[model samples]
Target: MNKGYVYFLTNYRRTTIYIGVTNNIHSRVWKHKLGEGSLFTSKYKLTVLIYAEEYDNISDAIAREKQLKNWHKQWKWNLVKQNNPKLEDWYDTLRGW
Candidate 1:
């Protein structure tokens, strides 16, 4: 079975946030950073990965992404903070994965 990833992205100012899921987190994030991922991400410059969760099933990853998207902004922020208290970019962690 294929695995999946659900991730949270924030802009440099940490004001904008985006939630997404993909089978390839590294490639997807690379596209977003290069301004070729999604219109919303490119428009908002949401390229700093703050949080990510792995799932054995792609369906669960998609569902979690949808659930996070529907959550309140504050709730989403809290979730990110819970995982990444410093809110630092985590793109580097994708290396060797």
Candidate 2:
């Protein structure tokens, strides 16, 4: 029974956005930071994790990721702002988790 996560990543300039789902947020994020996650993420340099939501079911996490991907850019940005006003890289916070 693995938990899952839906996360948002943006570049340093916060100009590009990427959304993804994973059963292990830490390792997945680490790969993205190293520019090995996906061609889209690598090309856009979307390494900073700005928002994340946990789910008990991986299917739910995947569904949520799909939903967010279809959302308008402004809507996505607003969602990130609601959860992370500062839009800080959340990788450091994962250390305590």
Candidate 3:
């Protein structure tokens, strides 16, 4: 099965948030962490994966990413807190993938 993902990354202090969708979440996040991803991610140093959701379809994942991107900062904060109250860096958890 093809998998898609919607994920969020933040800086060290959780001061910045980036929402994106990718078919290969691990690879995509790795690239971002290594500063080999988009200019925005690299410039902002957003390398900590704080939140993620998996999906079976790319379109749905893309739509969710777009929706989250347009949400207000506070709304996004609540969403993240619901799943990850501490907003801990999830990079290690994804390493085995």
Best by lDDT: 2
User: On a 0 to 100 scale, what is the lDDT of residue 94 in model 3?
Assistant: 74
lDDT of 2 by residue, 45-72 (tens): 9999999999998999999999999999
Model 2, residue 47: what's the lDDT?
98
Q: After superposition, how far is residue 17 of candidate 2 from its true place, in Å?
A: 0.5
List the RMSD of every prediction in angstroms: 1.0, 0.9, 1.5
Model 1, C-alpha of 61: deviation from truth (Å):
0.2
The digit string of per-residue lDDT tens for model 3 on 18-46 reads 99889998899999989997898999999
Give the residue spans of candidate 3 off by over 4 A: 95-97
Going through the candidates in the order shown, the clash numbers are 0, 0, 0
- Model 1 residue runs over 4 Å out of place are none
lDDT value, candidate 1, whole model: 0.93
**Candidate 3 lDDT for residue 3:** 79
lDDT of each: 0.93, 0.94, 0.90
Pairs clashing within candidate 1:
none
Instruction: Give each model a TM-score.
Output: 0.95, 0.95, 0.92
